[model samples]
Target: MAKGKVGKTVGSLGDYLKEQRVGARLSLRQLADQAGVSNPYLSQIERGLRKPSAEVLQQIAKALRISAEQLYIRAGILSPDDGVGGSVELAILSDTGLTERQKQSLLDVYASFLALNAADGADDATPAGAENDAEGTAPITTEIDPDSDNRVTNEG
Candidate 1:
């Protein structure tokens, strides 16, 4: 890829992280402290001037109460289709210190989590009733056919 494209992707990821931090009511110093990274280094990462390692990404995700895979996707280190479980498992398996048994255990746990989430989503999407259950609960339905570009219906 071109350098400009890479820079743009990095900048976009940085912007997203900054927005998330602000939304969580956290200051740069607070996030830095929580992530166990230097304020200047975190600032640099937030500005897209520095690329953080997977470990640093995990630390930031933990501090933000989010999945590190999500951060990895935003940073272009992983794709959205890879999913959190797969990406995290792959990252852990790549670590030099982890044994094969440990990697397998982690992968199994991640797979179970993904399966549970998928099952929950499937249950929600099933037609429980014609309308939503309650004020806070609603059924989500998407009509877009992935195989066809003409499936999109623009509601004016």
Candidate 2:
């Protein structure tokens, strides 16, 4: 790894690398050999003591048979734009049936939907004022009568 301004090593990136290596059933030495890095260096990376370069990460990704973009994301070198539709987005991008403009529109809409869902979840979390509420309301519950299946009852 060429020297760069090494900020704090990203813990998620280290964890991801370790997990991938283990999932592939590759020893630390084997991964280092395949990735053209040192065993000690790889060990440091896995332990979150060192941050590997993007090229090194790409090589590691290749050795693990995983997407380089995934490693880049874990390393915090790249932002995740695809969200849950990663493979779908890749397919859409490569599809010859759609024009570039059409593809762009589709991707934009998809990303917007993900963003909206995330925002909705954020709002669903405890609100600022509600966190200080001394009197809490009981959660509503609904149940069906076991004896008569058609009967419904609501309780709080």
Candidate 3:
């Protein structure tokens, strides 16, 4: 491919990967080691000088602890979708370390875990009262269920 085409294709993806890696507090060398890629190669990917294959992106996503589908969408390898994230699961399925039964088992367990969390969130979420406080002023309250296991504490 021409340098221009490759540059355009790699640009956003490289930026996305670099952002995720940085956000995850990983150095380029650390990310390369975890993703099983070379240090210079990862640097090239981050700088929009090289287009990474889907498999490399998957490995990088795994190392970054992100969903592979997100990387796939950023890479233009797959379009955005609203359903359950199957691409990450598909990556797990395709991995050589896991056998067929192991992959199926892992998928089943992961699905169940997601379902349980969704159910828990649905049950715990409640709107704060819209009434004024003892001082005749509306009291600021949280939208999050403090009793729940969510990481965010929403305030209004």
Answer with 2 or 3, whichever has the higher TM-score: 3
Q: Report backbone clashes per prediction.
A: 0, 0, 0
- Look at candidate 3 and give me any clashing residue pairs: none
**Model 2, which residues run further than 4 Å from truth?**
1-9, 81-156
lDDT of 3 by residue, 40-105 (tens): 999999888887766788799899999877786676545465265566566764688876567657
Please provide, for model 2 over 37-152, each residue's C-alpha lDDT reduced to its tens digit, 9 standing for 90 to 100: 99999998988788776567768988999987777667655447655537756565556787756866776687688688789778797653564454665445567788988656
Order of quality (TM-score)? 1, 3, 2
Residue 26 local lDDT, model 3: 94
Worst 10 residues of 3 by lDDT: 126-135
For all candidates in order, the CA lDDT equals: 0.76, 0.74, 0.75
lDDT of 1: 0.76
**54 in model 2: Cα distance from truth in Å?**
0.7
Model 1 ranges with Cα > 4 A deviation: 83-156
Query: Model 2 reaches what TM-score against the true structure?
Result: 0.48
Location of the lowest summed lDDT over 10 successive residues in candidate 1: 127-136
The whole-model C-alpha lDDT of candidate 3 against the native structure comes to: 0.75
